[model samples]
Target: MDFSLLKEAMESNSFEKIADICDQLMLQVSAQGIKFEEDWPYTIHLLGHLYVNDVNSARFLWKTIPSVVKEKQPEVVAVWKIGQQLWMRNYSGVHEAIRGFDWSPQTQGLITAFSELYTNKMFHLLLSAYSTITVGDTALFLGMSEENATNYALQRGWTIDSVSGMLTVKKQPIVTEQKLDPSKLQRLTEYVFHLEH
Candidate 1:
């Protein structure tokens, strides 16, 4: 298979750039021709949307994943499941998805990267979900020590109730550029943020 575009897409760290490259290649090869079935690399396309946290695109691609790909590269399915859990805001489910999976050496780096990405996402999620959260819970979710959690929270302008170990969001307007409904805890839904695609 011709993997030049896929390799170039993989070289970039930015998801948007990967998406643009994947989009251009997909458009070029998806026309009604023999090239569509053979030349299109679904893995790069899947990774591009997934890296950007676009679950709608991921869900659409999920059904189209070739069975052989799933069977041969089971880690692909595992990472996608983790992404789905992150999308749904189920931190525990992410752990469950990762537990007991024997990843080959080739896929270990991917798992590590996904773990790092998950921790970053969890911090933002916890901040969005609560005005105050227990340091213990934050540590648990982030897989970090309570000391680190407390320090990180403090660094982010959170007030620490040392006696209760509670990290409270400092009294200030939560300025969010995204039209997020603070009331919704699980899924991101508001204005144009809704998953229409």
Candidate 2:
């Protein structure tokens, strides 16, 4: 959506806001009834991308996986298995990149900027799943107000009308929320969002 706003959020190290935005977006997708499998390659790619801010690398991993697997079909199962192995291999590269990056105090700003980009790009992929997401949901996903989400969407060249159209094609909901301990959230936020900052 609003790359500028996202940039600002990251640069400011606003983890709570970012988490809120992500949650809102997830809620919107859930509301649309488009399900995402827990072990889906897309989910893995999303996490990897967020962790490393590398879309091309994430894409490479995602493309390696096969579309289907059959329990009774040995050949099909093998292909899918190989795909997963390759995907995991490539995913390790993202981890390596993060480790290799020169993240010093001065470069903290840059890390935050890229982190925001990674988060926003992930959100874009999620939005693409449903035709039209609600303004409220979108705002919540971005951790902004409805007006902000709409403005951000417009700036990104997405139209409300198109989002509405996508919502019409109902799919089974795959995403769900489990109650996470506050300590875990704090730890994640500290390590993932605030570490470099």
The list of candidate 2 runs beyond 4 A from truth reads 1-50, 53-107, 161-197
lDDT: which candidate is best?
1
Candidate 1 regions with alpha-carbon error over 4 angstroms: 1-5, 35-43, 95-118, 140-147, 171-197
Q: Tens-digit lDDT track for model 1 on 1-197?
A: 35565565455534456656766666555653444533344555655666676778777777777777777666668767766786787776775666647766634444556567767787887877888899989887876678987887788788988898888966547677977566774455554367675
TM-score each candidate.
0.64, 0.29
Residues 76-145, model 2: lDDT tens digits:
2322232343356443233234334444453345345544564475356545676667776665455455
lDDT to native, each model: 0.67, 0.47
State, as a TM-score between 0 and 1, how close model 1 is to the true structure: 0.64
* Stretch of 10 with least lDDT, candidate 2: 39-48
